[model samples]
Target: MPKDARNQSPELDPVIHPINRLRICATLYSAGATDDRQMKYSTLAELTGLPADTLSKQLKHLEGCGYISRAREYGSTRAKDTVWVTLTEAGAQAYVQHVEALKAMTEGL
Candidate 1:
């Protein structure tokens, strides 16, 4: 629990924010657990159960928001590029803050 978890604005209403969406962000960022590296789309899908296309689109949105980075790589083939996703500094901070915010909302009564 965070030091400030006990304090939060009821008006913020974290339930509306939902857990799974947050889970997607947090879990993906957890790739930092090993060498602060990134992960692939298939890897994330295995963890989050979000379809590839769905994850791709949502990831693009996160990238647009400056929360995540998306890179496309060529594998010596003419087909679509393999994707790599990583958390930017902004993304890591946002994940931490979002977790803190949600923890505050769920603090004991």
Candidate 2:
């Protein structure tokens, strides 16, 4: 457990602390463990119940932190382009650790 500035308790991961980010992480963490580890951007947006723009912004943050990878594939036509996202190994570990931290925080309460 990592301490915050006051060193009172384990600090929650800022990256995954937001509700939307936590939802995204949990979704990706479960899916990544399956045979099909990749998901379409649209599918993820649907799963997270977030608008396209919001999802894009959140995804950019996660990608910036090396938690996930985004790949854009273009079809023969311009409108056929599709984006796919997958969790990196680091992301999996982070998700597990975050879940454990959450559990610890609630254990004694």
Candidate 3:
């Protein structure tokens, strides 16, 4: 292995290693790639194909760790409320590092 590759053996981030969370991070990362860093909760739900409760649980965990931010947007009616989610700077950095680790592990394969 190259020295740079050898030095890139970053530990996998526990928070992002789970499939659900990894998907979430990947979605958010792609969104940011298009200059749209935030996404609606409904959009994330649709992308992940996860039930509401399960998605909520995962969001809460990511938010608790300061990896993501959640905000509520309310319209004139109670039915118009929406939740918005965005990946935080820290979260992006962590996810990128995790990906680098994955790449390093697969380099020789």
Candidate 4:
């Protein structure tokens, strides 16, 4: 077995793996759908306290996993386009896992 691997014990909580992904998913989870509440790139960066480049990489990863949807909305004229972020169905589930991961990482020592 590798130094770090899934625990065979069913007693242990089946969460807390992939801490980085959990953090990313947690941030995305807080940002609801555009229809519910549009989330801007800057806002996400501010809320997560992550740099734009890091956020961009995370966004691309999440989008590839079918967890989040990123859209560049442009107005008719020439103007700064808006970047919209929304959590997909998979994202919602991943968010739940992320929460569970936190609990597992910090529950009862």
For model 2, residues 1-109, the per-residue Cα lDDT tens digits are 5455335546578888888888888888777632246898888888889999888898899889988888889988868899888888887777777888788788742
- lDDT tens readout by residue for model 3, 24-96: 9889887882224579989999988989998999989988998899889998887899988998988899899
Candidates sorted by lDDT, best first: 3, 2, 1, 4
Tell me the tens digit of each residue's lDDT in model 4 across 1-109.
7545544222322231344445555666665553355577777777778788988887787778887788888867546777888777767775676566556556632
Report every candidate's CA lDDT: 0.66, 0.80, 0.85, 0.64
Clashes of each: 0, 0, 0, 0
Model 1: how far is 105 from its true place, Å? 1.0
Model 4 misplaced stretches (Cα beyond 4 Å): 1-21, 34-37, 76-79
Backbone clashes in candidate 2 total: 0
The reply for model 2, stretches above 4 Å from the true place, is 1-10, 33-36
lDDT of 1 by residue, 1-109 (tens): 6767535343432421445556667777676722257787668778988887777777777778777787678787846567777777877777777767656667742
Winner on lDDT (3 vs 4):
3
Q: Of 1 and 3, which scores higher on lDDT? A: 3
Which residue pairs clash in candidate 2?
Answer: none
- Among residues 3 or more apart in sequence or in different chains, the pairs in candidate 1 whose N, CA or C atoms overlap within 3 Å are none
Estimated TM-score for each candidate: 0.73, 0.83, 0.85, 0.66
